[model samples]
Target: MDFNLGTCFYILANYKGYRMSVEECEIELRDYDGEFLRRDVKTEGSIQPEHEVRENCKGCKRKIKLMDEGCVFGCCRVCCSGITKKISSFIGGKVRCCDVHNDRIIKKPTKSVKKPIKKEYVKRICIYKSLSQIIYTGHGADELLAGYGRHRTAYLKGGYKEVTKVLKNEVGRLWERNLGRDDRCISSGGKEARFIFLEDGFVEFIQSLDVTFIADFELGQGVGDKRILRRYAEELGLKECGNLVKRAMQFGSRIGKVVGGEKGDEEFEKSEKFKPPTTDPTKYDKDYRFDITLPDWLPYLQTHGYCVISSAVSSQNTNLALKSLITSLKLLHGNDVDTWDIPEHGLISETLGQSSGAWLIRGSSIVKSAFERIWEEKDLIVSMDCVIIWLSWLNNSNFKPRSEGLHLDQNPFNKLDMISVQGMIPLIDVTEEIGGLQIIPGSHVGVLKEEFKDMHGDMRGKGDWCQAKEEYVEGRGGEARLVECKAGDLILWDSRTVHGGKVGSLGGRREGVEDGEIARASVTVAMVPRAWASEEVLEERKEGFRIGATFNHSPHETGTSTGTVKGKLYEDYIPIELTAEQRELL
Candidate 1:
C-alpha cells in the first residue's frame, strides 16, 4: 500500500511472506462506439485492449440493442473502472429489452437515488475481513514534518526558532490532538493502526537532526516542508508523489464533501459556548448631560501637559458606554480578551473606534462640555477613535516595554501654533496597580517652545508620529508619571506630550467595572474646535460615518476608514443613529 499525506509520501513496497489475492466480479461497460457490453473478469488485474478482449469472446446469436450515449447501470463497474471510464459507460449492466424503437434500445430510467457514502471505512472493513489485520496509514507524518499552514506562518514570523517551538509543542501534544482520535477510528475495524513516522526510534532520530535538514521553510510551500522525506521519496523513484502539493487528508480524500462542507464549519463557529455575559444598561443611573463649564484644571493642563478631571463623565453614562463596547467585542472577537496580541499601547478594538456606540460617553453632554471648556469654544468636533480595553493581568508574567518607548502624537515641526488636545474617559477606575497612562510631565512645554528642535524631526510624514529619545526626556529633568483616576474621569493631554500606556499588574477587582472584569478600559475622546477642520476633512468624516470607519485622535485631520462594515462580523451589528450633536462632530 502507498499513501501521500500532506507533504510526506509513504510506501510499503515489499512484504516477503504475504501473497495478494484477486477476486472476480461481473462488470458492465459501453464500447467507444456506444454498444452495451458486459464482462466477468478479475477485479485486481488490468484490462487488456478492447480489440484483444473482444477476440476471445464468442459472438452472441440474440439481437443486441445499443444503449443511450450516457447512462450508467452497475455501481461496481462505475466505482472500479474510475471516473473517465464511468462517464463513457453511462448505462451499465446486461439489458433485457422486449421492444426496440427506431433501432435504439430504450428502457425507462429509474428514479435518481443518493446515499451517504463512507468509502474509506467500508474499504478498510473489507480489507480487514479478507486481506490483512494490519493497515498502514500516513497519519503522524504531518505533525512531525511541519506540513500545516500554521507552520509556514510561524516560520515566516520568527524563523526556525518559532517554527521549531511550534513543532515541539505539536509533537508533545500529538496524542490528545490526533493520535487518540485516529487510533479509535482506525481500530474500530478490528485492525491495528501502524504509524511508522511516530515510532519512538524514528521520532528520536528525527528530533536529533537539525530542524533545517528536516524542513527548509525558505524554499516555499510543498518543496520546503519535509525536505528530507521528499528527498527520500524522490530517491525511491516516486517523483510525482514527492512533488505533489500538500493537501489535508479530508480534502485529498474528498471526505469533506460528505461531511457537509463549509456550512458545517460555519455552524460550528456560531455554536461557541463561551458567550460573554451582557451588561445591563438599565441598571446604571443616567445623570449625565452636555455641559460646557471651564474647570480649574485648565492652568494645571497648561503647566503639567496633561490633566485628570475627576467624575467628568457620569457613572451611568460610563456603564452604558462600557456595555456597548463589550457587546461589540463579543460580536466581533468573541470577547476573548486573553488571546488578543496587545498592540504597542495595549489597544484593541481600535478598528471599531468610530462605531456610534464607542461615542456613547464621548458624545454625552458632560464629555462634550469638558472638551468645549478646554478649548473654550462651543463648536467642537469629536475625534473618531477606539476604546482601550487592557487586560494587564494576562501579560504581567512576561511584560516588557516597547523599545520605541515614549512618543509624541503631534509633529513639533509641523506647526508650533496648532494645538490638538487629546482626551480619554476611563469607563472604570484606574489605579497604579491596575495601570493607566504614563507620561513625562511638562514635555509639551519644551516641545511647543521648540527647545528640542535638534532632537528629532516630525516622523508623521514617514507614516509614524515623532518619538522623543529617552535621553532627551531625561535631559529635560522630566519624570514619567502614572496618572491614576476614578471611573468616568476625563484625562486630557496636549498632543506634544511624551506619553505611552504602562502595562498593569494583577490586583483586587475594582467597583463599577462591567467590561469582562477588564483591568483598564477607556474611550479615547478628543475634540478640536470646528473652525480648524476644512470642508474637505468634514466630507471625509461624513463618508467615514456612513461606512462605520475608525479614525485617530485628531478631529481636524483626515481619517482613514477601517472598512469594518464590510466584514462578516459587522453583519451582526445594529446600525447606530447619531444625535444632532454627534452629527456636528462628524
Candidate 2:
C-alpha cells in the first residue's frame, strides 16, 4: 500500500511509544483510530463501564433498540416499526411491555389491575460508549476482507468489475446504509461513534488492493477463496473470528428474531395482498410501494401518473374541512336517511359543492405546493368544482352492482394537452372500509390514450361519463391499485389517468366506525394554470362564486369557447369575495 506523508505521520504517531516493529505497526494501525485505545473491553451485559442502564424493554427485559419505542415497549415488529398496535386497551396505559405480551394481556382482559401504579420518571445523564469503540475490529476486518454476502454474490456472478462496483457503492453510501442508522441508534443511548474503517489511509489501502485477490472466491496464486485476512489470522494464531461468515449484529444477537425477522416472500405477499393492478414503471418488486418520505417522487410521478404526498396537509385543515362538511350535511339532510339518496347513476350534482368551508382545501399550502410541482409554476388556478362527501350508504343504494368508477377525468376530444391536474384530500383517515379513490397506473401513456380519444364524444355527453371498459383495464397488463390515503395526505393524479371512486370498502371495518356509519369523506380540487383561464371562464367563476354553485371542474366546452352555462347555477346565489390567489385561479 502506498502511504502518503499524512498516513505515515498517523502511523508513526500511533505506534511511536510502543516502539513496535513494522509488521506489528501494520497489523495494529489497520484497525486502530485515534478514538480507541490499543485494547479491547472485556465487560459484558447491556451496560458497560461508562454506559448506564436507562431502562430495559418490558417485553424481553433487554435494552431497547429504538429510543422512540417508549418504556412500555411492544416487542412485535409492528410496534417496533411504529405501525398500529394489535391491542386496543393497552394504548394509553403506562405499563411498558412487548406487543406479544400486550396482546395477551388485552385478550384476557378478565384480570384488570386495580392497584394504583407507582412509577418514577427520572432525568439521568448517561454517557454510552460508541459502537466504533466497542466493535472496531469487526467493522475493519469486514471492509478489508470479502465478508459481506453481497460482496461474495457479486464476485461469484460478475467477478471483479461487479465486486468493485459493490465496494464503491458501499463506501459512497456507507453513511446512508450503515453509519446513519448506527449513529442514530447509538446516539439514542447517548453515545457517538468513531469509525476506524473511515480513516483516510486505511480506506485508501483497502480500495487499492487487487480486486481478484480480495473478492474472487477461487483458490488462487494470490490467496484462498474467502477471507484473505484469515491467512493473517492464522499467522497471528487468532482463529476464532478468522473464517466466520458475516452476520449483522442485530441478527447475531437474535434481536431481529425476537421480533419478526426481515420479511420473507410469504410475508411480502401477505402485505401486498391489496396492491392493485398497475403497470410497473420502475419495475419495483410487487411489495415495493413508493414511500412518501423518499425523494424519488418526480420520477415516480412521471412513470406512474399518480403519487401520494403523505402528511402533506395539516390535521388542522383536515379537522376544519370535516367539521364544515358535517355541519353542511346536517343543514341539508337533518338526520334524514331518506333525503340522503343520490341519482340512480350514483352521481350527485352539487354535493357539498359550494360551502365556504370548501375553501380550506383549495387554499392548502401543501396542495398548492403539489400543484406547483405538477404544472412547474406558482401561477396556477384552483377549479371551483366537486369537493365530494361520498356517503357509501347513499351512493351504494342506486349504483349498479359490481360497477367500479374506473374512468379518466379528462375528456379526450376536448383538448390533446393535459389542461388540469386533480387533488384528493381526505378529511378523515380513508380506511379500506371507507372505500375511496383507486387508479390504474401508467394507463395514461401511449396506446391507452389513443384508445380513449375514440370515445371522447360519447364520454362527454350530458354529465360526461367516462368509464374504463373491462377489455381495456382488465385485459391490459396493469393493475388497479386501491389508493388508501390518511387524513391530511394529498393525492395527485394526471387528468388522463384511469381512476375512479371505489364502490365498497376495500377491506375491514374502520376503527370506531359503527355499522352503516359515514364511509368516505374527501374533498376534490382541480388545478389549472392561470394562463389557461379565458374571459368567459372568469365570468362564470364569478357568477358561480356569487350563487354558491357547483362550478365545472374544468373549463366547459361550448362550441369553440370555454365558459360556464347559465342554467347550471343554483337559484339562491350568495356572492362570496375571492382572495387574490382565488381570483387568479378563475
List pairs with backbone clashes in candidate 2: 72-96, 74-99, 75-98, 75-99, 277-479, 277-480, 278-479, 381-585, 546-575, 547-573
Tens-digit per-residue lDDT, 1-586, candidate 1: 1112210111122111112222210111111222322222343222322211122111111222233111121122222223223333344423332111213323332222122122121110001122366767776677788777577657645778898899999999988867776655555445577888988998999888878888875453456678888989999999988966587664544323332334333545546775656532112122211112323467667666777765565566778877777676665667575455455454654345755457677666556656666777778888877567755343344332232356777766664543778888888777756677776666676543365556675443443266567667677524566677777777888877777776555543475544334666788888989898999998887776666666777777755322111222243344478876577776
lDDT of 2 by residue, 300-419 (tens): 666777777765556766778778876766766676534754333232335366565677767664566566656776677676665555554533343322334587656565544666
Count of backbone clashes for each model? 9, 10
Off by over 4 Å in 2: 1-279, 282-295, 344-348, 392-404, 450-465, 505-509, 555-570, 573-586
TM-score of 1: 0.44
Question: Which number leads on TM-score?
Answer: 2
TM-score of each: 0.44, 0.46
